[model samples]
Target: MMEMILKTKQVSEELGVNPSTIQRWVKFFNLPCQRNEHGHYLFNEKHIEELRKIKDQLSEGLAMTDVQIDIPKKEAVKTKEFTLNNEIEKRLDKLIMRIDNMERRLETKADEVVSAQLLQHRLEIDDLVKKINSLENTLLEMQEKQTFQMQDYHSDFMLEKPKPVKRSWFASLLQLFSMIKS
Candidate 1:
């Protein structure tokens, strides 16, 4: 069976807690959770149960600092940025293809109302496309920032090879004689 993973927003809604509060809980409680490449929390059902228990405890006057979280040890999900991008792109492509097919079918119907509705839906899809573009841009910006940070880290911390000292012929001969005597 495929395991289900919930996003932060979904988890918050499920637990009837504010999203920010949930984020704070995750931070303060050190809840073990998976994060997407963009650093968004990807929660499993166990996380939801844990959060619910935490919420109940807090509601019962338990101190936030006193409450402890016990997340079960599990392998983390490996959802890389490129994989997410490819999946989203594939879904968008399918949606566009469906829209194109619908448009083609609607063209033969000769119904003005249906045509207007299709236009509205197309506009909505265009809005989605714009949002996807904005998200892609954000991902690109994040990748650029990470690259620059890594570059800075390497520049600041990387070691260089020391240059060999140049010696005159007299100095070399004296060192050789001293070694020969020894």
Candidate 2:
């Protein structure tokens, strides 16, 4: 089977590295490559494997100068997976923050609604209090009028002279006797 060959751009994409880095790797690390007619470097699977090994060693805290190109056991790249997970976490965090903001806004709106209702109730209470005061004042005026009328009736009744009562003849005889005695 023929080996699959890829251009510099394709290698850059596969390695998740810059095309310049791949070119530098070709020059500095002596990365295996074939020159096309245009003198552009073409990479094969072997070169990709060696790049993966170098990347692994770099990730393991080895300096670029210290990294060896010899292929270790083949393993999947962790950077891509790590990037995806990081992105997902970031999105979830944003979503959580948005939800929290919405909740706060809803709470504020609810508080405003309650405040408005309370204000309306207070207005109603104020109106009721005013009406009650008006009624009380009217009642007080009515009472004052009734008390004046009672006082006037009482005074009028007292102003009238009482009629004299006729005494019995026996009571008149007793009175005449008493006058004689005096």
Candidate 3:
């Protein structure tokens, strides 16, 4: 037993606990031990092997001297808190991403609506221009017909008029005065 020894770190690793925990147990429980010249605990291999058996027995639901084998309460609480924080962070990230996507979609829909309104307005303007052109053509044709009718009337009036007869100047002057009065 004196030829074999285990360090605190090695013992803690095998026991699946912190070295400080083992140190507390050793101090509080008054575990039988011997210190080297450096004042460090020196444990025999057989002693550690025996402790392992006791730990395994406790793990199998056995109570040694009424000492429960439950994990430390503080560590379990901290672990639960860490898990909750991680879960909340993940959900928050997802929610923010969803909101961003919705905002982008809304912008796209607004752009589409604006584009449709612009297209509708353009179509109305084109239709109005076409109607105006048609009306202008109709007005031009009406004016041309009126001009031709006036020219035909003038030609007919000229054909019906009698030529001036060879007469005294006084007689022609009297006929012109009579025509002006009529």
For model 3 the local lDDT of residue 130 reads 100
Better of 1 and 3 by lDDT: 1
Candidate 1 wrong stretches, greater than 4 Å = 72-182
At residue 56, what lDDT does model 1 achieve?
Answer: 93
| Candidate 1 least-lDDT 10 residues | 73-82
RMSD of 3: 16.8
lDDT of 2: 0.81
- Give the residue spans of candidate 2 off by over 4 A: 1-84, 165-182
Tens digit of per-residue lDDT, candidate 3, span 60-166: 88544334323345422334544455466568889999999999999999999999999999999999999999999999999999999999999999889687778
Q: Tell me the whole-model lDDT of each prediction, alpha carbons only.
A: 0.81, 0.81, 0.71
Candidate 3: worst-modelled 10 consecutive residues by lDDT:
68-77
**How many residue pairs clash in each candidate at the backbone level?**
0, 0, 0
Predicted structure 3, TM vs. truth: 0.38
Estimate the TM-score of every prediction: 0.38, 0.45, 0.38
| Model 1, global lDDT | 0.81
